[model samples]
Target: MQATSRNFKDNAHRALEDANLQKAMGFVRTGFIDKRKAAADALPEFEALRDAARDIKNHTLANLDRYLERYEAKATETGAQVHWCTTAEDARETILEICRSVGARTATKGKSMIAEEIGLNDFLERNGITPIETDLGEYIIQLRKEPPSHIIAPAVHVTQDQVEADFRSHHKALPADRSLAEPQQLVAEAREMLRQKYLDADVGITGANFLVAETGTSVIVTNEGNGDLTQILPKIHIVIASIEKVIPTLEDLGVILRVLARSATGQEMSAYTTLSTGPKRPDDPDGPEQYHVVILDNGRSAMLGTEYQEMLRCIRCGACMNHCPVYHAVGGHAYGWVYVGPMGAVLTPSLIGVDQAGHLPNASTFCGRCESVCPMRIPLPKMMRHWREREFERHLNPPAWRWGLKAWAFLARRPRLYQALTGLQVRLMGLAGRRRGRFASLPLAGGWTEHRDFPAPQGRTFQQLWAERKRAA
Candidate 1:
């Protein structure tokens, strides 16, 4: 919601000083990455699955219109109402219409980035409806009156202590002296509080993990059973998903599902993979009376013909951020948007204006780990570089970096000057290192040496060494 990423240094400084935050981040760093690694090791055909998944996504994007129409037809035929919203405004209007038609007062929502993108909860609240978050992570952040910091783990920065405080402060019925020490206690408290809300709520909203066109089913994978309760018990069920989530077949969904769990939290599979199609049948025991799937475009279709088309393949795995050196140092809040890390760098600029979010692309170290671990195998670095190019062309690049590139380009065009400049650099480093084999501080490089000392450059330039060896031969 901030529109721009904050400085990495400032965000990191805040994170380090907060004891609770440090504990929470430490848990995330260890748990998610380790689980994913073990899961990947167990799957012998993981690489093959990755390749197949990439093809499935690419194929879907290429023939998106066809799949969308087919999906709508099949979903409608099964008694589900499918609404296509081309922009944020259109999506908001469609949802409002549904809410008004149902006379919905209280809404229970599962975690949906697409809903976040469209600002659905705020709209509902403004229209005199109370919408509650059912996901544990989302519930914590919502109670604290904060937006999500990470895409997958919304409250990854919140420690157990923070959760206890939030529940104590918000839940009036909770005991005054209750020692809410562990996760189980916290979960139990929330579950007890929300049990009545689900049965009482008029409508439920959920995001789709995958929309199977073959069966007109919208699949959602959740660790908790909250999504099921959110959809089934309520009289009205609303699924807010992007149009891109559709897959042609369950087999295709299986390929993506294989990589999704392994890439997301390193689980063989999530605890629940629920596939729902429309409202409950008359013969059905208990289910929603109405079902509506709001398929939102919100600039995603625009990315199809562009260089960033590959980014649409993302399954929201969060692997890129898990392995990013910069993200490890700074955490999600630094990216200052709905999405974060490498995928965010490419997406923020596109979703928001390039100028507004151009700084995000520059935040990466161009480390290849993100792409390597990406379940979708999206060319993240290449996409980020494209954002960088967009920034450069529009003159959004900082004057210092722009000037440095210009200077480097000028010298690079002249081999003699370039070699001379390199010779001077090497000689200066040698002279500087001679005193103590290192320099604690450097002239323009002080920031680099602030936390880490620069490794001294080699004494001779490569060109000089090559020339001398040629003469000797």
Candidate 2:
């Protein structure tokens, strides 16, 4: 809702105080984690599957160009139009042109982070075309006139009461006497409302989970069957996805699939895993008449040979965010991107520019839960450290922090000074503990003392303890 993600602290403060948001966060913590654990426990080879999945992604990315060309050729052979656009505007313009040719006025859309990356809805709406979100979570946020907060669960910041209130306000045609109760009832109301929109829609757009290069198929997975409706019911279907989603084969897809659901919602697989290869054939009973695959390369090519290339392996499973304590407390909107949590911290800076989003990489406890749970095994904290390095190299860091880092670095490089500093700090903390057990307010630690007390240093510094042991021996 804000113009930029720069006001994270202020926004996080707001999120922390929201009781409704806390309830929503509670569901995410228990519900998502428990579901995934159950799914993982059901499979004896879950860890092995994760390893295989990571290998497939790594292999695919290494030969990305080759696979992409093969995919384009295969897709063309199948009668699907493959459009490659290097920029978001280029991709949007190409899609809009295709829609215009078909006289499409209304479009139904499935959940797509790539679409969010390009701001496609606003672009379509500005041109007087209505773009309707079809996914339940996405639909909720859209009706509430808000941007998605979470990647997997877009409306994770909203409570059930808030959703009911939104549905009542937006679904004005529904009688006031009609009860706005139960998840199922609310779902039925939305299902009925969107069913008409789907039937009447001129164009349907969806994002690909994995683009099978070998078969020229765009794979879309959903818990709801909306992707099927979104693709089939409309006369035309558009699949817009990033180039990085491409995998070599269906066998490779299976490996990733095993880990994807378990890491995200802990399902063996989502309810629907639809693979559409081109448009409807003459023998086909029902499908889109026209199929278009738009491959987006919005700054992704730059990450190809770079240290951040591992990030391309992300399957959008959202495991990292779900396990994040900071995200649980402050919520996804604080990160201010379509992708949030640890992944967002690394990605937002790259996509939005480090100068504008440098603070994101620092918004971490660096607990490494993200890396531990990541199915693709992307070292998120390591990537984030690279962002921090870039920020320092570019001199984009705040002047105060820049000086503080310089001072710390100077001391750290010199062991004598570092040891002396640590000893002094330990002595002062020990003295403070003797008086009050722990420090409520500590000088030179304005950041930590703000919300929490600093634990007293254990009797002595590590260096002091080690030196005394050596002397005794």
Query: Of the candidates shown, which would achieve the greatest TM-score relative to the real structure?
Result: 2
Show where candidate 2 strays beyond 4 Å. Answer: 1-3, 434-436, 462-473
Task: Candidate 1: give the clashing pairs.
Answer: 36-266
After TM-score superposition, what is the CA distance of residue 284 in candidate 2 from its true location, in Å?
1.6
Q: What TM-score do all the candidates reach, one by one?
A: 0.93, 0.95
CA-lDDT, candidates in order:
0.86, 0.89
lDDT of 2 by residue, 1-473 (tens): 22367777787878877888889899887788778778888999988988898889888899999999999999999999999999989999998998898889999999998998898998999987899999999999998878888888898889888989999998999898897778899989989999999999999999999999999999998999988899999999999999999999989988898899889998888999999998999999999999999999988888889989999999998999998888888898888766788998888877777887777788888999899989889999999999999999999878988999999999999999999888997987788687677788887887567667888886689988888999999
How does candidate 2 fare on TM-score?
0.95
Residue-level error in angstroms, candidate 2, position 13: 2.9
Best by lDDT: 2
Once model 1 is optimally superposed onto the true structure by TM-score, how far is the C-alpha of residue 165 displaced, in angstroms?
A: 1.7
Expressed as tens digits, the lDDT of each residue in 36-108 for candidate 1 is 8999999999999999999999999999999988888889999999998898789888988888898889999
What's the true lDDT of residue 106 in model 1? Answer: 93
